[model samples]
Target: MSEKKFTKIDCKELKLGMRFSAPVFFDDGENMFLGEEKAVKNYHINAIQRWKIDYLLTYGHLVTDGKTAAPDSIYMLEDLEEVEEA
Candidate 1:
């Protein structure tokens, strides 16, 4: 299997109702944090802050209404492969 790529997102920067297109992973990138289609809620943010987590990683991009969400407060680091293609 090909190695999976990941994007690291800051917990404090996640906007209300933001959703991921794929399952979110923990720092290790193997453990699942939240499933796809699950919108970012108050509780999720609370837990991350309460636990003092710095960020989360995922193989998916942010989505809303089946489209890629535009960057707002979050400055998503570009995937190296994507940058190379551009």
Candidate 2:
């Protein structure tokens, strides 16, 4: 990554399940596999003046019987790494 900008995620544009990757770990240490973007607005509002994460990413899909659920709100800082074309 070449100095990519960390922009705030728009809750409205965000859907229930979307995939994203970051560099930091979520609150839960053991469960670092992935997380979703559940309740974006609630997460955003509650995140202010707290942990202070610049950006957020949806881990993956939520296990549901039929009804769709929002992703996890655990926002982790993503370190940009530059990959050269081979």
The number of the candidate with the highest TM-score is 1
Find the candidate with the highest lDDT and give its number: 1
Task: Give the range of the ten consecutive residues with the poorest summed lDDT in model 2.
Answer: 77-86
lDDT of 2 by residue, 1-86 (tens): 67433334443444444334432223333323233323334444355326554444333332344544333422221212222322
Query: For residues 1-86, could you state the per-residue lDDT of candidate 1 as single tens digits?
Result: 99879999988788667888899887778888788856676667788888788889998898758545444334235545567889
Q: How much lDDT does candidate 2 score?
A: 0.37
Estimated TM-score per prediction? 0.70, 0.24
lDDT of each: 0.76, 0.37
When summed lDDT is taken over every stretch of 10 residues in candidate 1, the lowest stretch is: 69-78
Clashing residue pairs for model 2 = 1-81, 1-82, 23-78, 36-71, 36-72, 37-71, 37-72, 38-71, 38-72
Q: How many residue pairs clash in model 2?
A: 9
